[model samples]
Target: MGPTLDSSYEDWVRVAEGVVPPGRHRVGGREEDGAGAVFAVVSPRDGSTLASVADAGEKEVDLAVAAARWAFDSGPWPRLAPAERGRVLLRIADLVEEHRSEIAALISLENGKPIAESYGIELRAVAGTFRWYGQLADKVCDEAPHTDPGALALVTREPAGVVGAVVPWNFPLTLAAWKIAPALAAGCAVVLKPSELTPLSALLLGRLVDEAMEEAGVPGGVLNVVAGDGPTAGRALGLHPDVDVLAFTGSTAVGRHYLRYSADSNLKRVWLELGGKSPNIVLPDAPDLDAAAATAAWGIFFNQGEMCTAPSRLLVHSSVAERVTDAVIQRAEALRVGDPLDPATEMGALAGAARLDAVRGHIDAARAAGARLRTGGAPLDPAPVPGGTYLRPTVFDRVTPDMAVAREEIFGPVLSVLTFDTVEEAVALANDTEYGLAAGLWTGDLSTAHTVSRALRAGTVWVNCYEEGDLTVPFGGYKQSGNGRDKSAHALEKYTELKTTWIQL
Candidate 1:
């Protein structure tokens, strides 16, 4: 059992002040001063100031990058045996688990995710990710090829040096783990820039890392964290010539900027897990309409629809479109949207006022474009959760493929409903999006499931379930959705460079 958290704003402020001290930046295993520019971290839960911390700019970013580079070039991290590194990572994972309750509380207070989800899904995944990569550290091996009698050839993978990771606000700690754990396991030093919107958890993670590394005898400067916005700190890390790799998870627009930065600078490898407007297709042969409707609502409304792989666009066969749409509306309306800390709440506030406004704009645009509003279309009254940025789940029926609401990534609990007459049409509709991170299909026929899954351009295809999988499966996107996979053994490829050695006697 873990310590109980007080969800009141005053109590949260007290906790946050202690967890994230002022002028926080972890460099070389020590708390360092960041650039004098401080940013107020506002809680989307009740629009209150949680705390203020120094924001990293170019100067601070330079310090962080230099620390990471020094750690890689002259420090003991890369020189350590693979098994030793694995042991250190395992220790870090244990520390994360020990602090699970506090982490979940911070996420709920800062990022506006439900406390239950922050614990059950986000924090649990963060610890599991570290454990998974920790176990994989010693398993990575070199290969020897059978060659000519006079020659010997060996292929090996080596760390890519300093890795600059820029993570987003949604599931901040979990996404950071996706990049940081793998990079560390591959023997790379890291300079992580967590999103300014929610830096508390990542800052707390830095503290945990410092303690774990100290306990495990891992050297200082192996991991540095910089908290700031994209323009200054993120760009500095991206363009730093000494930084050998950049791993980013955010919007596609920002992902493209990293590519340009890579081209303009050292041409370091960039791995991106970007935006998605994923489709959820419901066929006439769907196993069960009730189950499908429930899954659809959960898919979009979960995390307040801020997930990159959210099933925002729902496609149904004409025969069952009305039935499925009605059922989905019923499910959405039944969801409890209130204070995130409340255990009974199914959904919570948006990350900020900007997100709430963006969702409302999308709803208005859809209505003007002649789409039928089947359910919620406005922000919830502040009476339930005063000052919180809350919105009721919205469903737009009779939405065309060409509508703005259907085409854009709204990043809210807004569902766009479209109908298809045949399997071919469904496939076409699902493939029409510029983003292809993920897609889902509900069908009883195995052939239809297999055929449609293969036809979809998404990186992940869910046949009967939505957002299903574990750490073993690869997650990424195709086309404009971005490049490079995150999770599973496939993720290790991005953090290392391959080299071939030949010997002739």
Candidate 2:
């Protein structure tokens, strides 16, 4: 059911030797030398250096963009039939499934997610994304508009030239797939920049892409990857004049920067999926209180609360606040924070030391700002998992709407509880923050559920659930959480531009 994280370094070394090439960047369908600046890929689990990877500078980014541009303009990729492109994407999906174990291992080891989650959720999503987009490739068609009897009008969707995709560290492979699969399926060339913190899995994906392209007779220079920090590679890709579109999933701060980059440069199309402080509302209804409590715990504690759509703010009806808070505290305290590689571990380390320090700062700030510490505020001892960046799952009660903990995105295993007396107050409290990414409400009244779901400002709202959805549904955010959708047919629109052609008979 889950992968065993007990695999030795020697075991991973063998796999890495095969999956990751000497140079991480794949340009023009081959591995190429990166910039001389090399950075260590440090593991958050025990703070070990897994490997050193080349950091892509402006020069490397230029090369990648050029390759993508050439692929889009003169290469065979865009010229291929939509059905043929679909077949190639299907082949890529097959290869990803074949190497699922290795990809999952790399993700857990590099990003500090539980091995079980890496295998069960992340890897599976990666494969499924390609398949979904593959199936959709041929389905998209041009429209023949109703026109005058003597005239004909046609509207078509064409691939936007080079697509520059920059994905964050959390859920690296799955998020990358969200951008890459659709871009390629739309017959666009891609130059992907994976976060430096978790480049291993993306680089491994490059191998699969290369193999699949060769097998499917797809041309070289269609897919390129450059691993580096956001400032260099990310900025270069954003500001590059030839790049027709940019897709990014990261912090709101960086998302704004890309918008500025587009304006200052060629005004390329920019799609962003950014930060969130999503709220979870528990109402006094006919549903079981125990189940609501468990769901509340899962909303915040899952993935160590490092999710952009994490339900960090829990709003419970005053009548059941104490009961639900108690249940959530019990569940938080019971979570096991240890080795990510261990199959039994429910929670793992933060991505790195920087993230660990950031989470601790938020915890201290919340306590000082008058939030009551309910359970598990202290960091875990390092004795069991030496050198690992482990933090305790924390829950704070008696939190007010204006408190810093409730307002800001801590992005850790920190949950803040607020009690509301009326539905209007609950909606106000939920929308108090700048984020509108997601929200969850648990209630037995069908009318109340529907009413609150519509009233919430978030892009995605769940009734009696949290973070439940599939590729078929569109996922994105509203307000400061950022712009544009990630999954579904809506995502394809971001990779392609619409054109109209009119003819007189």
Give TM-scores for every candidate, taking all chains together and pairing residue i with residue i.
Answer: 0.97, 0.96
Tens-place lDDT digits, model 1, residues 83-171: 88888888888988898877887888889988778877898899999899999999988999999989999999999899999999989
- Clashing residue pairs in candidate 2 (N, C-alpha, C atoms within 3 angstroms): 5-341, 46-387, 46-388
| Alpha-carbon lDDT, every model | 0.89, 0.88
Clashing pairs in 1: none
After superposing candidate 1 on the true structure, give the runs of residues whose Cα lies further than 4 Å from its correct spot: 4-23
For candidate 1, the 10 contiguous residues with the lowest summed lDDT are 1-10
- Which stretches of candidate 2 lie above 4 Å from their native place? 1-23
lDDT of 2 by residue, 1-505 (tens): 2223466544544554454433468888888777678888988877878788888999999999999889999988998999999998988998888877678878877899887788778988999999999999999989998999899999999999899999999899999999999999999999999999998888889878988988877667888989999988899999999999999999999999999999999999999999999999999993788988898888788788889999999999999998999999999999887777766778888889999899999999999999999887777875236888888999999899888999999989999999999999999999998989999998999999989999999999988888899999999999989888999999998999899999999
Give the local distance difference test score of model 2. 0.88
- lDDT of prediction 1: 0.89
